[model samples]
Target chain A: MSTSTTLEAPKSGTWDGGNEPMKASYGKLMMWFFLLSDAFTFGAFLIVYGLTRHAHTPYTGEAEAFTFSTEWWPIPEKVFNAFPGFHGVDLPLAFVALMTMILIFSSVTMVLAVEAGHRMDKKDVEKWLLWTILFGATFLACQAWEWTHFIVGTDEGMLLPDGTTYHGASMAFNQYGPPLFANLFFFITGFHGFHVFIGWTLLIVAFISTVNGVYHKRGHYEMVEKIGLYWHFVDLVWVFVFTFFYLI
Target chain B: MAHHIENDFQQTAEIPKPQTKAIWRTFFILVGLTALEFLFAFTMDAGTARNAIFIILTIFKAFYIVAEFMHLKHEAKSLIWSIIIPLALVVWLMVALLAEGSYYYESITNYFK
Candidate 1:
């Protein structure tokens, strides 16, 4: 390696998101590139979560001395454990686990849809697309329910001396952790939920086009493969969110 | 012109039929990893070691998704690095931000608590 290197711009044979030297289409490559940038944004938000969580450690000297204080961070299991149709039941991480399964299953359906597209089978593509949309919708519904319960927090929050309570989840506070906890939760989960909705709508369009025999006339399912890339990328981000936000 | 365009489309070679079994295998691996994460979560208390394990498993799932589901593993090396290198930078960003943020957290707690 030399410290001083001459710089030159190549006049030919360059790949700049448009070139096909990678054997992938421009749209597919761009989608990957865009996801890469999106990953950084989500990563930054999670890092902020880590930062705030670290700041709010509990008093850990002795049992008698340690009393409930406003600064201590809330435990994960204690914060999120309510399941749908289970009134006041304690199911730690069970419902979120179900949400994870739904999301992962949707990813599988998406890949199958892409596979059908590869085989130029419009009927199978439409079938798989429908399944993917259903799974995505189900995941969204679960998230909505989780959010509702989160805001309605089953935990009866203590009254602050300042005449307000840290109930459920809000910008001001939550019974969970510090004030920042609720903010980070809403930002990260809300962003990921928005992405799922986007993918779901795109999939709807792909399904409709497949039903109209559009790929049949075109003799290819490039559209399906392209959308598959996006869908898979969304699933990949959720893996991180699941780990950092929910499980960990 | 329409006939010419259709003829041009045919000239481009297409890959073999869909690989459904391969995807099923990927799905099983993802499910297995998730199950392992849950097992760890339930068995172990929240500590540095558990956090490390969670991060590693999460990254493994991320790799599987990118390489297998996104098909980047089969793509050209240059293309793979073009995306991978930037993603690595994001990891670096995490380290940097977390370090500074931890410092701030320490200072605040020391003063207030």
Candidate 2:
């Protein structure tokens, strides 16, 4: 009885040997830690990108139009100057802005779904989850289009060191700035896009489970909460990627 | 067997009341910050000052997403600190590696010259 009371004495404290140490459930706590580690993974990628970029000299030419040069780092706005359905028009950062809005809106929808789940409103949860999924898929489609445009070169191809003109970007060649530019672009954004794909799939799973009355029967919607953490983390990473890779 | 399964499905914790107002407010804040980023992208010159501004804005956006959208703010203090404190290491990594990168750049330029 004395030992039991001793254990109970610390019941309200964080390390009280309670099931919830940090006032979060076991699954939610695990999810938070997972995201923390995931943040490190993304942090490493962006840092490596920054490190490589620091190695290059900045472009200092006075060119009005986009030109492929291996002498210095290409101006980002010059390289990414195409908007969908606007052929031959020089619109920089517009498409990525649209992409950002799509992602942010999707994140809002995801949080709304979590909010609905808190109230045990299954119909509302399902509706918002569907919206989030739609937005996610739309964002993925935009990424696909962006990648295709990047791979299909602009009118003026870059002159390679070997006396050949390279039009598109690959693992070994990039018309934009340097080969490392394309490599990092593919690595960082590809990894991020894969995260979006996984988040989308998870949303679908959550949606299906909601439709099947899983959360309704289970008496709580912590599943939605856990997945919401992941979805928001993806959005958060993109904010940095947009700033570091595109804006600056 | 049925009773045991039913017991497993019990609610784990109390669900807080819905904060629809705050959610919409956060949405608008995010949109406003993004608009500001776009404005700066065009209006500001490309240099260290502009990059600093972008980094600050990005951090603000990240805060909103993690604190509000992910509901980290409402979580326990210990949990919040546990996540934020460790992320300081990332800042250290950035400082150390970016310095190394610049050193490499200097090495190449100095050697060739």
Candidate 3:
């Protein structure tokens, strides 16, 4: 398929006259563009998050001692205090921090895969890609646990403006605080989770292709590098989300 | 036959060596930053100062990820500028919206309550 392009003499120049004006492969450059656009999408979400959050009355409750109310925004640590296997213990930011570590580690593995691809070390590529996929799934699973806790909130439900107590959070109501909080939480994290799912699926495909020696036959592992760009972008988005959503 | 084969095959560039050491170094830096952020989140009181610190640290982490993890730092200068220049607009959007949002908050507190 690519033979015709290679038939011509290999042209060379940094900026004066090369086919790759940016010194990057066409696929890689296109992937960078795609990621840049994706960054804007996430940026908009997080900015809107900041705007809406600022619009709400700031939470002024003492640290770790908070109650749900509609009068102001709920403290993030108080809201996301649940941890697996630690029932009734308020471990604020711990689980989310663990999730952050998982994602960062996974990004490490992904870059390793890309590095392996550079060396055309197919076995290492397969190994690191598998590790990346595993970590991605683990992050998703952590998110699922978090969502479950969010949806099935604390037993001591808060009183709504209507003088009725409501438990848990849905699109219509939130036991934590304002409705916008739940909305942004579901939307921002949901959007990010979907990206992780898609990236995970792409990693699976890349892993399978590596196992089948597809890139081996093609004489280049550019596909792994492209997907690596995507996977790293996902991790990059999570760092901001970790700060704006959970931490700040 | 050899010359014909050489002409038929594409001239593949030399593959670059893997920088595992740099990768590990970046990973450690990211982890340390995250730990520091966690510390600040808990120790510091909720205020503009804490929030500003968080934003600055987040930006630092972002720079490392983009430059090292995504390999944007090693890319051609033209490519580097192409990506970073557009993101400045996002910063503009943020400042504008934040100012607007605070205005909304003030109006709500003054009138709605």
Q: Give candidate 3 misplaced runs (Cα > 4 Å).
A: A1-18, A161-163, B1-18
lDDT of 3 by residue, A107-206 (tens): 9999999898877777789999999999999999999999998998887889766787888999988999899999999999999999999999999999
Candidate 3: lDDT of A67? 77
| TM-score for predicted model 3 compared with the true structure | 0.90
- What's the ranking of the predictions by TM-score, best on top? 2, 3, 1
lDDT of 2 by residue, B1-113 (tens): 23345534333445456679999999999999999988998887778998898999899999999999999999999999999999999999999999999999989989889
Q: In candidate 1, which residue pairs clash?
A: none
lDDT measured at residue A242 in model 2 versus the true structure, 0 to 100: 92
Cα miss at A143, model 2 (Å)?
0.6
Per-prediction DockQ: 0.57, 0.56, 0.50
Q: How many backbone clashes does candidate 3 have?
A: 0
Interface RMSD of 3: 2.7
Please give the distance, in angstroms, between residue B108's alpha carbon in candidate 3 and its true position after superposition. 2.0
Task: Rank by lDDT, highest first.
Answer: 3, 2, 1
Cα error, residue A71 of model 3, in Å, equals: 0.9
Question: What is candidate 1's CAPRI-style docking category based on DockQ?
Answer: medium
Interface RMSD of each: 2.3, 2.5, 2.7
Clashing residue pairs in candidate 3 (N, C-alpha, C atoms within 3 angstroms): none
